[model samples]
Target: MTESPLTIPIYDGSLVSVRSTGSSMTKAQLTTGLARRKAEPEPKWKSGELPSKYQCPSCSNYLRFPVQFEDCGHYVCSSCLPDIMRVASRCPTCQVPISKDKLVNDKTLQKDIQSLEVYCTNKDKGCDWDGTLRDFPVHFETCGFISVDCLNGCGAKFEKRFMNKHQKDDCPKRTVSCEFCKTSIIFEDEIPHLNVCTEFKIPCPNQCSTEEYPRGKMQDHLENDCTKQESPCPFNECGCEYRGHRPDIEKHMKEAPGIHLNMAGKTIALQKKLLQLYEERSNEQKNWIEILARKVNGLEKNYGAQYIWKIDHYSERLQEARSNKKTTLFSPPFSTSRHGYRLALSICLCGDGKAKGKNVSLFICICRGDYDSLLTWPFSHRVTFTLLDQCEDPDNRRHITYAVKPNVCKENRPFLGRPITDRNASFGAQKFTDLDAMSTLEYIKDDTIYIKVEIDNEEMVPI
Candidate 1:
């Protein structure tokens, strides 16, 4: 072997005392010796021959950390020394008498064995790595030519380079499951098969105990087959508090008619009286709201009313709304004074009357405030709704203006007003704007839309 010249540093300074330095010294010695030997040029090899001199005489394998007998210079591998001593109290190579107590470590031979350049075992299999015998373990760990078994224990081996691909795409025994439908499948063809796994389990939206019901049958099962579902009784108007599975309730009703009839008569009379009270309260609330609204409007006309209303994530709000045919949202009530009459802006999607579904209906309605007792009676205002244009273009900004007539008719006013009248009223455009108009105008951006409603100072006119 061609060797690199060894360089040693000489210390002229006195050594300082240390509590622990044995580990550092041993590491430094190993590192320096290995580096010197690794710098040597590789040796040429003849067929089936090596330059290792410390070979075991018994099996003829290369000796590592050879042990020498103290009495003689003959050396043998420490691994085989035990077996040799058991057979006879002699060295296998020299037949010299030996014992465990008489054997000493042969450091010189260990250095030679560590310096011998060896080819990787996979060199014949296209690996070209060359390193000292001491480094063979590390080289073998990351060698590309080295074979690895399937992680799933499929008994198939692949080169380290192709092992990942084999497990993810080629290995038939690899365990995999669909992401969307969660059906177990083999890795091979898992992607294509997942797109058509029709029988995958999905949750019943009605939250039935059958958690893994088939996806395609969910609607039908919830509507007709689910036994745990609750429904109103057939004798609903008879003040029955029982809500349970429909079939059992129907059976109970069919068996007892006289009892149910008597219950129904008393139930109707009580319901009528309750309804009448609700109507009366509702009327009082309407009158209170009307009085408060008129007071706020009158104050706004006297002192300028400036308010900005913002509704964000307009699209998400629409999607979350439970009503498929109609839905309405109301703004927080605002007043012209600290405790003056209050009014709120309302928008009904899918409309309420003739303009239903196709248009966005806007309204300004009365809200009862604390200062209603000190306010006026009749409520009226010219309300204007502005659909803000989020885009750079000015043409998209559209305004819907309405002229609201004052409730001078006594029957048309609410009972809560100072001069209490028996009615409820609001002012707005039934078809303020169409859905198509809002979309084409690009009124909503980033899933958000803005609406600006203000009381117009102009005098009210007939509709």
Candidate 2:
């Protein structure tokens, strides 16, 4: 073959014969040929860079293998074909009228354009894929994007992508059970159906909830959250499950408690068999209270007088000793007295009748001074000071005071006066002068009272 195309020897592991032929060129020759082809001038095509990187304005997507109108410079991504055919059937850039079939399709160019597509902008939203311009719209509609579901108690999930906007508007998964009625509905429908459910459980009419509520706990269940519920009698604590209604509750009180009192109505009865039994108990309590009270006209006439007697028998003895003059230290014979301080006095009135008129006026005069009620008040004894009768005689002037003194002796902290001041004056200001009988009782006095304590010291303006 014409000198065998001038064979040359090459080393490719072993010696091999290489030849240059018109059909089979040498490596350098093939490379030189390619270079020459690249450097050669290519005839200018009618559309330079035709069907390249044009993007659709409507979709904001890269146009692969752009389709051009026959008469216009306007180009569009092939991916937006169906959309562009509808309203904008003309070339967008050149404003030329177009028919759907007039646009060109370049399959070879489209393949090249396809290689240029990239990952979707929404890839981070739980999508994991890439696509070409012509195929990306379909992929986006199906891509699973994780988003919060509108349903109550529904956990977060990757929902179907296409319905994102639609699910937000008409999603059935966004429903919740109502607290009042326990009915299921969309959260937005809650306000509408709040009063709709007929079988909804609500609080009972008579009482508060106790236990296993909305079943038996009614309005009479004692307005408390932690109240002991109406449970089976603890006669046997093995969870006696016999829960009873509130009205008949007393029948199930703990087996036996020594003291029993029943309130049938206005009368509180200390019930027992014998009238003497009632008398004995009341007398015992009466003795306990009289320990502090000045023995006066029929004091032991109220309830629980016997219980007080048992509490303060010794105090009663000391009081009786002082009264009988049997104790030598308590009352000194012919004791001489000298006043060391001045006593302050003032009068105020509080009346339920609210009358400033003397008829309904509550008259109060307090002998205020250095000597304490501890020493002076007991002289009146553990007693209540209350209005007994209004003095009608203008001459007597002093409001008539009567009281069932120490009437609340059963309660150690019984009220002793109306609006009692929680203060005691104990400063030693004035020095002693008199040592015997001529010493007058010195008292410091004030007459004004305040409606509220926060106001600055009030000036007593004369009327």
Candidate 1's residue-wise lDDT over 1-463, tens digit each? 1111221111122121122211222212211222233333232232356644656675465654466677776766544554566567687767888655555555567777777778877777788888787787687788887788888777898888788888887888787887756777777668567556666567766566756766667767876767666777667667666677757767777877888888888988998999999999999999999999999767656553434567776776565443653377777877644544577777776565777767888776667666666755565555567777777767755554444544557665652243322223455778888777767656777777777766644453311
List lDDT for all candidates, in order: 0.62, 0.36
Model 1 spans > 4 angstroms off: 1-48, 70-72, 173-175, 179-463
**All-Cα superposition RMSD per candidate:** 26.3, 29.8
Which sections of candidate 2 miss by over 4 Å? 1-52, 56-61, 69-74, 77-103, 124-127, 146-173, 177-463
Assess the local accuracy of residue 89 in candidate 2 as a C-alpha lDDT between 0 and 100.
66
Error of 1 at 332 (Å): 72
Q: Supply the TM-score for candidate 1.
A: 0.34
